[model samples]
Target: METRELRYFVAVAEELHFGRAAQRLGMAQPPLSRAIQRLERRLGVTLFDRTNRTIALTEAGTVLLREGRAALDAVAAAERRTRRAVPGRPGLVLVTKAGATGELLSKLLDAYAAEPGAATVDVLLCQPGEQERLLRDGRADVALLHRPFDSTTGLEAEELYTEGQAAVLPAAHPLTDRPHLRTADVAALPGLPLPRWPGPGGTYPPGPGPEVRDHAQLLQLIALGRASAILPDSCRSHLDPGLAAVPVLDAAPVTTVIAWPPHSRSLPLAALIRIALRLGSEHGSAALVRGG
Candidate 1:
């Protein structure tokens, strides 16, 4: 019912031990236990199954954990945005994967700056799988997300452009001579495993490929004949001279979409979205977010 209650419940639910949760919350165990009991009584449902040695969530507790997290995130987003909306300097924060958006970002910024009442756009360049978290937490107002790579679970999106992917490798590699490649062609390259990218939790998937944090690192690995990568074709322009790109004909097209929170109603954000869609309309697909 209250933010404090939710915070206490979340801390307990996550820790599954009042003693540990109390330590994390800088409180004593007895009060935390009583708080949980009171919360359960108020809700008319037992949230956790507790014993002297251990504790676990009931089915209801699990559901509350999921929904409660969303509610907390919503609260955090509200507080963050409100604090940022100080008078005299209205601005919008847009985050994107570093080195991925390239020319489209330049064009979008230029076009949006020309619009009336445009807010100053503060751009945040971040690592892969970071834009969603940034946007969700209200650290960023909008983000350029690539489809099939960045998940858009609860956000709205407008497609700006889509293009086929390319397999980037050393210029001297035998595959560079080919006009295009198949997935198998790229996969079977001797000693050149696809570089493993870290997930949202910052851990790489199990693989023989060297872990890479950004395009530059991946390119360096490729230059050293230590790795290979499949990236959207638009990255071709930024590729180093020692690198070569061959279209992966069977690879899915990467869609660059401008995404924002579903509850966003900012006028400046709307105008900028329009300009992005209008400018990008000429380059590729203009598909809007489905059921947005």
Candidate 2:
């Protein structure tokens, strides 16, 4: 009927003697005997055949012994799994941006995997808008967001690095001859192509535009001299023979931030946040040098 009763039943069943079962359980013989009597009463079955000199299991006792051992084993296994999921143990969720941030997140996650008690990180590649909702709803443990978070109350964000934008152009384009170009320079180019904005209510600044969904297509258009697009410097490293990147002048830097629910500041999550910030900062700095 209860775990304690089942444990008592198991000890008595194993030892086949009330006196020895009481000693094994570290309890008095009278209490142990009464507990087994209550267990038999709850089940409406006789568990033991007892005489003045002998004690042995009845048919019901044999069945109960088998089922009771299985039930106790299951409870033990469940407790083991619960302990493993505790704070300071390994297990984490990372919600991230689509492009460069995603790459950075992957590297940090791999490093955490090698550490002792490191959490199994579930990385969710998400859009900027979904971060607040994910954190609020408990779908994610931490998020890497492009800065200027819309909501700040339920979350804590730490600025990791600032990323500058660059112009992607066809290698032979006239602008490619210059070491870098400004927004005005690209805006002034004749028939300059730009990717279509994909965000909700997304619209690019007034200009000649090509409706493109992702960065790869934007690169393809640049390669064909059909258009030029502006993106973070980290994207510049992905250039091919036909495509080149020129730095954008006087553009605001997009800051990448590490964010987590304010309530989840446990030791393990805090440790993971530190790792993410350090790695992201290092990567952003490296990208700047390489792109430059």
Candidate 3:
């Protein structure tokens, strides 16, 4: 019922281990366990399936975790906005992946600034998969996310562009000689495996190649013949002679979307969204994907 209980439950549900969750929360295991148990009792729901050796979320626990995260986000948003509402300082934070959509971002910013009452936009560049956290935790007000690849969960989005993908490889690589590729062809390269980026939970998936945080790392690894990555075709503009990008026919198209929390209320935030949509309408190849 309280933020403390919700916070404890979320940690346990995510880690699925009381001891690890307790360590993360800077507490001991028994109290964390008791807090979760008390929460379950108060709600009359079995939140977890626990044994001496294993702890797993029940269906009810899964539901609670999702809802509890949103509740915590709302609380964080309230605290952040309260502090930011100073008399002479109004600003907005726009977060996006570095080296992605460079041209479009420049234009979007220029257009938004032309508006009569635009707030100063602080552009925050982050690593892959970090945008979602920035928006949800009140660190950011808006984000330019690529969906189907970027997770747009718990946010509203307006599509900005859509384009195909390409497999980036070393110039001398055998696959570079091919006219194009399928997704399977890129995934099956003998000497080079796809570089793994950290998942939303910040854990790298099981993989063979180097772990990468952004396109710069991925490109450096590819240049050294250490890895290959299938990235959006737009990445071609940024590649140099050392790297060659061949289109991947079967790879899904990447859609760039401007995403924000649905609960946002700032007039400046709304104005920025309007400017971005206008640009997308005039310049984007694909139709806008509004929130469902």
Q: For this target, which candidate reaches the highest TM-score against the unseen true structure?
A: 1
Give the per-residue lDDT of model 1 (tens digit) for 10-89: 99999988888999999999988888889899999999998889899999999999989989999999899999998888
Q: Provide TM-scores for the models.
A: 0.93, 0.59, 0.81
lDDT of 3 at 164: 81
Name the lDDT value of residue 45 in candidate 2: 97
RMSD from true fold, candidate 2: 18.9
Report, for every candidate in turn, its global Cα lDDT versus the true structure.
Answer: 0.89, 0.75, 0.87
Model 3: lDDT of residue 249: 94
> Candidates 2 and 3: which is better by TM-score?
3
Error of 1 at 174 (Å): 0.4
Please write out the lDDT profile of model 2 over residues 29-79, one tens digit for every residue.
999998888888888999999999889999999999999987876566445
- Weakest 10 consecutive residues, lDDT, candidate 3? 283-292
> Which residue pairs collide, candidate 1?
none
Candidate 1 residues lying further than 4 Å off, grouped into runs, are 285-292
- Using lDDT as the measure, the top candidate is 1
The local distance difference test score of model 1 is 0.89
Q: Return the lDDT, model 2, position 260.
A: 77
Q: List the residue pairs that clash in candidate 3.
A: none
Error of 1 at 11 (Å): 1.1
> When superposed on Cα atoms, how far off is each prediction in RMSD?
4.0, 18.9, 4.8
Off by over 4 Å in 3: 8-41, 45-66, 285-292
